[model samples]
Each structure stands twice: as C-alpha cells, then as structure tokens.
Target: MAPRIGVVTFPGTLDDQDAVRAIRLGGGEPVQLWHASADLKGVDAVILPGGFSYGDYLRAGAIAALSPVMTSVRAAAGKGLPVLGICNGFQVLCEARLLPGTLMRNEQQRFKCSVQELVVESIDTVWTCDFAPRQAIRIPAKHGEGNYVADAATLAAIEANNQVVFRYLHNPNGSEHDIAGVTNETGNVVGLMPHPEHAVEGLTGGSTDGLGFLSSVRRFLSVQV
Candidate 1:
C-alpha cells in the first residue's frame, strides 16, 4: 500500500487542502487529520501546513499546540514518526516542543511574502533526503512572525549537531545563521517557515522545487517498508 500521509487542519488552518494535493501529487494518500481528534488514523507521516491557527492569538501557534490532536502528534513524534511543520506549522512545532526554538516577528516588523530561495543545508532528515547538499530551491514564504531564535546554548547545540536543514540564500526574515529550516537530532521531525505545498505546481506556485520535500518522505517510507 502507498504511504498514508496525514495533513492536519486546525480551526484557522488555510493550507490543508493544498498540502493534501501536494501529498497526492507526491504519490501518497493524503489523510485529513482534524485538530480536535486524538486519532491519527495510522498515517505513515504527518504534515502541519502553514496558516494562522487559532487566529494567532497569544502567539502564532500557541493555542493550536494544545489541541487534542497535537497530544497524539507529540506522542507519535517521540517514537520516531516523521512530521513536517511548515510556516505557522513550524511555530506550532516549537510551541508543542516537538522542535526547538521559537519564531518571533520578522526583524522588519512587517509581513513578508515572496518566492524565497533556500539552500538545502542538510538532507539527512526524512523530510529532506531527496535533495542534494547545498541544492538551491525556490518556495513561497508568507509570514509575519518567521524569525527563528533559540537560547545561546540551544543554538550552539543545534549547530554542533548539524541540525540545520535549510538556509536562506538571501536572508529574508533575519533568522539567526540564515536558517530556514531545521530537524531534530533523530531527524524524524522537521520544521520550516516556507510553504513547500504552495510551490509544488509551477503554474500556481512558480516553482516545482517544493515537490522534492513531499517526494522525499514517500521514498523514505517505501524504503522503510
């Protein structure tokens, strides 16, 4: 059977459908996982797409991180489940403590939207194995709070562990170390500020580069099986 990938939808999530389409295009069955449900439906992988969950109240992803489904997601992720968090989803991951660091408002203090270029810094993670080291790809990024920051010790640890997954070719949000994405030590979870799902179709997203991320997971699952 093909890998069943779950795309989570929070109350304010806007990109779940696009994520679902990207998963199907990447040769996986897309399962819509609701925020309030604790069950994951036995998905092989999970994706938290970009959007303003819970109206970005208190913090971008703070509220959604406490949702019932996230409890299950946290547990599953602990057992080496593959999870990819994009944009606000990235914020959610951090809020849920699945990944390290916190996303703060952009240095410019304004929302930015652009087709951003990023360098694949690490391909060792399940979400990034399809890309070659130092490969450049363009993906759409739209966010008001996307600057990633961590404590000095945490940052040092992340660098020492080579956890950085993607780096911005031209820094857009003043993220420390030009980091665009990162993975956990186990490399089973990844979080990025860019919306890869939007970049899967050239006609709509102006680039097909993002498809590599989705495709990489499917290939990983196939190998695992």
Candidate 2:
C-alpha cells in the first residue's frame, strides 16, 4: 500500500488541499484530516500546511496549536511519528513545543511573497531524507511572520545537534542563522516556513524541488517497514 500521509485542515487553513495534492504527486496516499478530529486515521505521516489558522488571531498559530487534533499529534510525535509543519504550521509546532524557536515578524515589518532559495543544511530528519546536505532548492514562501528566533541556549543546542534542516540563501526574513527550517532531536518532527506543497509542480510553482520533502517521508516509512 502507498504510505498514507495526512494533511490537516484547521478552521482557517488555506493550504491543506495543496498539501494533499503534493502528497499524492509524491506517490503517497493523501488523507484529509480535520482539526477537530482526535484520531490520525492510521496515517504513516502527517503534514500541517501553511495558512493563517484561526485567522491568525492570538499570534498566528497559537490557537490552532490547542485544537483537538494537535493533542494527538503531540502524543504521536513523541513516539516517533513523522510530522512536517510548513509556514504558519511552523508557528503551531513552536507554540505546541514540538520544536524549539519562535517565529517572529519579518525584520522589515512586511509580508513577503516570493520564490525563496534555501540550502538543505541536514538530511538527518525523516522529512528531508531524500535531500543531500547543502543541496540548493527553490520553493514558494509567503508569510508575514516567518522570521525564526530562539534563545541563545536553544540556538546552541540545535546547532550542536544538527537540528537546523534548511537555511535561507538570501535571508528573506532576517532569521537568526539564516534558519528556514528545523527538526526535533529525534528528527521525526520538522517545521519550516516555506510552502513545499506549492513548489511540487513546475507549472504552478515554477519548480519541482519540493517533491523531495514529501517523497522522503514515504521512503522513510518503507525503510522502517
């Protein structure tokens, strides 16, 4: 069977469908999961797509992080489930304490919409297994609060553990260390401020670089099996 990957839909999430399509294109079964549902439906992996969940009220993904489904997500993630959080989803992961670091507003105080260049800093995570270290890729990035910040201790820990997964090539939001993405210490949970789902197709996103992210998890699951 194809690896079933779940894409979560929160109240104001706008990118869930896109993530589903990307998962299908990457050779995984796409499962639509509602934010209110507690069961993950036996999905091998889960994706939290980009968008202003809960209308971005109370600080981006703060409210969405408390939804019913997230409770299950946290428990499953602790047991080694692979979870990928993109864009505003990154905020939710941080707020839920699944990952370290807080996503702040852009240093320029503006919403940015652009094709962003990023280098894969590490392939140790399940979500990035298909990528090579230091590999350059381009993907669509649209967000107002994509800048990543962390306390000095947290920064040092992630750096020491090679948890930094991706780094911005041009520093679009002035994130510390040019960090665009990170993974948990176990490498099963990952959060990034770019829309890999949007970049899975060349016709729409002008690049297919993001396919690797989805495919990597499928391959990871197969290897485990």
Give lDDT per model, in order: 0.93, 0.93
- Candidate 2's clash total is 0
Candidate 2: stretches off by over 4 Å = none
Question: Residue-pair clashes per candidate, as listed?
Answer: 0, 0
Clashing pairs in 1: none
Indicate which candidate wins on lDDT: 2
Tens digits of per-residue lDDT for model 2, 7-57: 999989999999988988999999999999998999898999998999998
- Error of model 1, residue 19, in angstroms: 0.4
- Point out where model 1 deviates above 4 Å: none
TM-scores vs. true structure, each candidate: 0.98, 0.98
TM-score of 2: 0.98
